[model samples]
Target: MSDKLTPEKRSWNMSRIKGMDTKIEVEVRKYLFSKGYRFRKNDKRYPGKPDIVLPKYHVAIFVHGCFWHRHEGCKDATTPKTRTEFWLEKFDKNVKNDQIKQEKLKEMGWKVIVIWECELKKDFQRIMDRLEQEFKK
Candidate 1:
């Protein structure tokens, strides 16, 4: 479907979108905190400015929005029909940047974890359990 908002309006709406402290990120943080996991948020010292960093475990967690991060095969990861080329280019760049960040974090001896926004909506417990397993590693 075509965009309902004018270009100016769309720009304003997009500008309001946040890069950090998102709802899903907050949810994950709460859960982890409740589970006795101490973490630092968006540590400047790390690649990608991970949403949650556990220094004790040498782990970095990123809570990614499906559309923004283009979670592979995720239902929420839909391409915008309005600007095909623009969206594709943007998404591709996002994916590439994410990969680079992950590689960099790995090279720095940090276990990287990515949690999709959709996962927080359904079966969030699974993500928590997987985190537990990762922590145990």
Candidate 2:
């Protein structure tokens, strides 16, 4: 755990970590857009600022990074080698927040759709198909 990161480098790397508009986000959005599906990106009015919002279908899509959202059994979601306890607490809180947001959105009559980063990587076609079906319904 002796790895040293200068403040500038650490800040730069941390800054690159966005809550949205990630690689998977761009890919999913591109595919959906190509399929003629329109959505609002990161709608502010939504509880979680959903990555993609289709008011027409009353649906919201959240694309969660495996590590950030703690996708179980996902290799990409391994806890940090350092600050293990802190990361555990952070991940747990993130999951709790997600659940709360989903419940609130549902109560408000919105269909919530969550796509894991690993799912997108493992089977982009299947994920896209699911989204299409969801959007259709």
Candidate 3:
């Protein structure tokens, strides 16, 4: 199917999408800070520039949007009807990169945590509790 928006409009919309300091990322950061969990945001020294880095716990957290990160079985992970192949390839690359980056972090002895956007929407409190437990461990 063809795109509903004009090409120029679509490009403009895509350009407006933020790559860093997204809404979900900020929310997680605020929660961690309020709980006294000191962290660095998008530390460039890390493999994937993790959204949150807890140096004390040696942990790296990635706040991923379900659609962009291609969260498996997630309702929000629908592909665009237009340019199906391009979107598929992009999603595949994102998933692969995530795995590679997480693996590298683990090899460096850092605990990696991925927080999906949908999970935060569905059960924010539960996810935060689990995150706290990870730090405690």
Candidate 4:
């Protein structure tokens, strides 16, 4: 096995992270709120506990981090030079889980909106438009 961050250090690093209410989450929430859209925050009752939930619109939003969610072509999604196998495995599992969650949410009749961290810079407006479309549907 490759050696980089020790198990203890990795645990600490991961532990310090927050799954929800992150910077991107806050920004998206604020933007949606500014547009007069109101919703729930991380309702565990839902399949993925979406970042923002518009139950009336049957829409669930997930603000995904590029690094964690492994967004393709994302600058923030660089793999570590060390412990390559471990990091790749972790990212692969994350991607798989995301797919499962989206499928489950869709099966429940919820329209899923995935906002990637990189997309936030270049496609924020497009994301909003898609969300609006979902609301209209």
* Per-residue lDDT of model 3, residues 1-137, tens digit only: 68889999999999999999999899999998999889999999999999999999999999999999998899999999988999999999999999999999999999999999999999998999999999999
Runs of candidate 3 with Cα error greater than 4 angstroms are none
Clashes counted in candidate 3 amount to: 0
Tell me the spans in candidate 1 whose CA falls farther than 4 Å from its real position. Answer: none
The lDDT values for all models are 0.93, 0.90, 0.96, 0.88
Supply every candidate's count of residue pairs whose N, Cα or C atoms clash at under 3 angstroms.
0, 0, 0, 0
- Candidate with best lDDT: 3
Q: Could you give the candidate ranking by TM-score, starting with the highest?
A: 3, 1, 2, 4
State the lDDT of candidate 1 residue by residue for 36-115, as single tens digits: 99999999999889999999999999999999999989888999888799999999999999999999999999999998
> Could you list the CA RMSD of all candidates, in the order they appear?
1.2, 1.6, 0.7, 2.9
The lDDT of model 3 is 0.96
lDDT of 1 at 92: 98
Provide TM-scores for the models. Answer: 0.94, 0.90, 0.98, 0.84
With a 3 Å backbone cut-off (N, CA, C), the pairs that clash in candidate 1 are none
Residues 13-130 of candidate 4 have per-residue lDDT tens digits of 9798998899879988998899888899998988878899988788999999999999898789989877789989999999998999999999998899898888887788888787
Residues 46-123 of candidate 2 have per-residue lDDT tens digits of 898899998889999999998888888889888767778998999999999999998899999999999999899889
Largest TM-score belongs to which candidate? 3
Candidate scoring better on lDDT of 1 and 4: 1
Q: Which stretches of candidate 2 lie over 4 Å from their true place?
A: 4-8
Instruction: Tell me the lDDT of candidate 1.
Output: 0.93
